[model samples]
Target: MHRGTNLPAVGGYNQALILDVIRRSGEGASRVELAEKTGLSAQTLSNVSRRLLDEGLIRESGKMVTGPGKPRTILRLEPEARFAVGVHLDPTVITYVVLDLEGHVVAHSRTRTPVGTKPEETIRRLTVSVNAIIETSGIDATRILGIGIAAPGPLDAEGGQVFNPPLMTEWHNVPLGASLAASTGLPVFVEKDVTAAVAAEQWMGALGDLKNSLFFYYGTGVGAGLVVDGAVVRGASSNSGDIGHLIVDPDGPLCRCGKRGCLGDSVAPVSLVLEAIEAGLVSAPTGELDSVTVDNDFTRLLSLADEGNGHAVVIVERAARRIARGVLAIVSILDVDRVVFGGPFWDRASRAYLGVVPGAVADDPALMMTHPIRFEQSKLGADVAAIGAGCLVLDRVLSPKPTDLLI
Candidate 1:
């Protein structure tokens, strides 16, 4: 529970703090209960609750006769009081979502990322798509707080730019955040895709209850999102989760980074598809493989492995082992007991990877942690990073930090 201050000047902080507690309370909370939980005086709680009710952020649901004197009215969060927009810029697809204050996705859309297009052209498309989705959702523009974007990293987050990501060759030092903000006319925040994934898991998924965990993101590229001491870790440059370069297999595959068997090159969807092509399990495309082509081929490879194809099984098993090895190193370093798996490609590979990874990590002689590790697949599905991006807007507006009390 977040404690509230009696100081008069920080009323805004108190209001946000109270609103946060009310939102988290599923059944709603009474003024007396809130005061008890937040360590606020009855008068202070009453003032904050009145402000929230006046702003339409919270409502008096009904009267609850709990044990004592008069009936206590339940104060519940008004979930639709505000909205947020989330956009995920993937190498293959761009996802957009509109989220209500309660973190529910009210609307969503997906578009294939423009291949061989200039960043300026792509941003124009993004602007058009964002406007279209907002209009289609029937949401009042005034109710929207802001837009948040999740993108591939090596981001200049402080400067609101996206440095050239490995998969996105055309996007070099792109001012994505500023450009989107200028076009959309809303406050915009940019976050690394994996970091946003973990943030979404923490905000809306079961991971919120855990103190420490790792979100192993398996997308076009492989990365990890970290949660330590119940907080998402965004390192110095807001590009913390870059596990792709971890050397998992020394003799496996040559990476663009001039290294052999890097975790990303060995287990990425494209790599798996290429391996399948080499092994005669998949037909190689006649022309250069675009994102869509690689996606389709990767799906085919997974389907073949699922159908008991011996060669496909070997490839998947090997990839799973390499992923496990990389995960082991990370888990050893972080000492987190919980590991979550999700991303665009995670669903297709979950059955195979899940079957191998948990046991492999547990049985490894070099495993560092004595406690049993728990693995879970994200319930947010493929659009998790997008949803998380929206949550960033909501979190910024509603969640109260101790720093807010710093005077």
Candidate 2:
């Protein structure tokens, strides 16, 4: 008989493998297929499958034929076995996604987070929204792994605390995770939204199979998330990818980080729009940061540029060039081979960056000596942060380890 993976720190290697396999397979798989892929034996797979089934993690459907003897039973992940809550706390609005074990979003909910929304009120709304989702979905509370929060950077991921998050003012050293945990009575993890996007991309995005990869997340704010050697490179403070603070220009403009010429200050959407207006390139850039969500603005910018809007063209191009400079630095230093771009602002950035990046790198004497980096759209869709936030808990429950039985 095979043993169960319930050890501490290591988590459930078997469960993780099985769940991840199903997560990626989409249409689902059979026990024999899983066993073949994972190298787990028939009896061991049976044990694992039993536990998963008992916990409603998977369900048995019909059977498929291998040869002439007997039809093998098909096993699939029970999508509704459990639920995970994902919250995207942007500046003006709150988007919620309730995902089941199969990574299916059963219910989506959103609300406003106005200029001076209190932390306490936000937490209350979150709890109520979460409970309402569960109440509506009829998913038992016990089965909920917990809530995975995807918020802006400058946060302590491990501690679940916020530290002067760029967009959300009046929040410093706030125990975001702890407060949410206390209120909901569920395990809560607070992650930089960019990192969450990277996670989502890894399993479903353009970075798949690229172990050493860089994900440039451009949204309401700009940041980077790195997967070095197939592991999340959450630097010394668990806040490594807030590259928005990276100083790209020494004497350019003021940054939210109290510095001048930071890349974010140079190229973030807020900067681009403001610069366009100030340059008299745009007449009335009346679009408020909160008015157009990242997704919408990105689309609009792309459309405007396509329609021959000179101001939009310049604003987007400049941002793309600045982005290229920042990306080149990382690719050169890390010898990274892949770069996937996504976020609310990706549509505009993608079209513009595609032109700027290759040229920028090709012109660089250093990268010109090596193979060019590959840049592409996120394989993951718009709901990356929310999906990846849910997958975070799923990862904790499923990631592999060294001592697992291989065949």
Candidate 3:
């Protein structure tokens, strides 16, 4: 069962609201600042401050001597007061991260995922990994709030179940959240990996206070995460952001879903590697390039492209162009001003894609009437989804939005 209710305590919502205000005020805020920002009475602010202080959620950091009668005590969040665990499940890898109250990753671990592994095996492996990290971190178990899991979608997030993700065909209808919770004795919150990545950007990224943006997540697969009004946009079934199937090229290769030139089949790592191999860039002495696994082939092609291999560069550029087309279509329809490119693929392909994608979007005629769009690389690197998962835990417990209020 999901241990923490989405609806926070009636007073809990107000307390969380104050804490959020403090967290954003990195320089610390006086009680007056809290009252002014939160629109709560001075008396209410005092009561909340006292409770937060007694609970150790917030602490008086220092005194700000304004133009005035007395030095005002400034308060700030105590990041070490609580923690959340984030797990990112990808077809190629599984990443775990422990995040403090302020969304900084304190500890992390990564392991290669066994493709086609059964759900039970994957669950067991995940449980052990989660236990090991928490045990080694030396943080008191009670202070650990809960676990957030970011898994590849087409998932039933509300139900804590994973459906048939494109790459991981074996994970059909797995009760991931309930099973993990039962195994670890902790609340488990599951989200689509792409949506979770968007949450990370919204919670702590360069795009602060920007209400609308799209995250183009390129991992073992290609997907998009949408944010509107500072909340992740999940379509009615909680499985939106499945941009992989959007047909980018009618004449391109066939996707695994039996469609022609779907986005997933176009720029997915496996698709890129297969393209490289077919183009003669991934050849070997034994003609055994086929023996190389998907990740290895993809990494080799990206490495070659980075080293200025002409063939590899051409392949990357083509992939970037295809990706740009998809991005342009998305930006035009959604009218999102900020577009972020990220995931494990970002680290290696940033140089290649950045060279072409921004120009591609900028040159598009659709932008003549709209404000200039900003294209950025992800600041959180590969940990974006994992951190976002952790943020999901923190957001449920600490964010002060109206949805958390029980009217």
Best by lDDT: 1
lDDT of 2 by residue, 1-407 (tens): 12334333323577777777866676778887888787777777777788888877888888888789778877777777778888877665677788877667787776766567677777888888878877887878888888999888788889899878867886778888999899989999888888888887775444557688888887767788888888778788777786776776677688766898788778767666566557565455345545455335555666777677887787777677677778888887787888888775566557666877767766866564366677777865556777778878766665554465443
TM-score of 3: 0.92
lDDT tens digits by residue: candidate 3, 4-91? 2222245677788888888888888999878878777777788888999999999999899889688999999999999999999988
RMSD of model 2 against the true structure: 4.3
Model 3 sits at a Cα RMSD from the real structure of 3.8
lDDT scores of the candidates, listed in order: 0.91, 0.74, 0.85
RMSD per model, one decimal: 1.3, 4.3, 3.8
Model 1 global lDDT (CA atoms, 0 to 1):
0.91
lDDT of 3: 0.85
| Pairwise TM-score winner, candidates 1 and 2 | 1
Q: How should the candidates be ordered by lDDT, best one leading?
A: 1, 3, 2
lDDT (10s digit) by residue, model 1, range 1-407: 67788889898788888888887888999999899888888999988888888988899999999787999999999989899999999999999999999899999999999999999999999999999989999998999999889999999766779999988899999999899999989999999999999999999855558578999999889889999998999999999989998999998899888999999999999999999999999898999987998999999999999999999999999999999999999999999999999999999899989999999988889996878899889999999999989999899899997888777
Candidate 2 residues lying further than 4 Å off, grouped into runs, are 1-44, 67-70, 135-142, 205-207, 256-259, 281-304, 366-369, 400-407
10 residues in a row with least lDDT, candidate 3: 1-10
Residue 33 local lDDT, model 3: 79
Q: What is the clash count for each candidate, in the order shown? A: 0, 2, 0
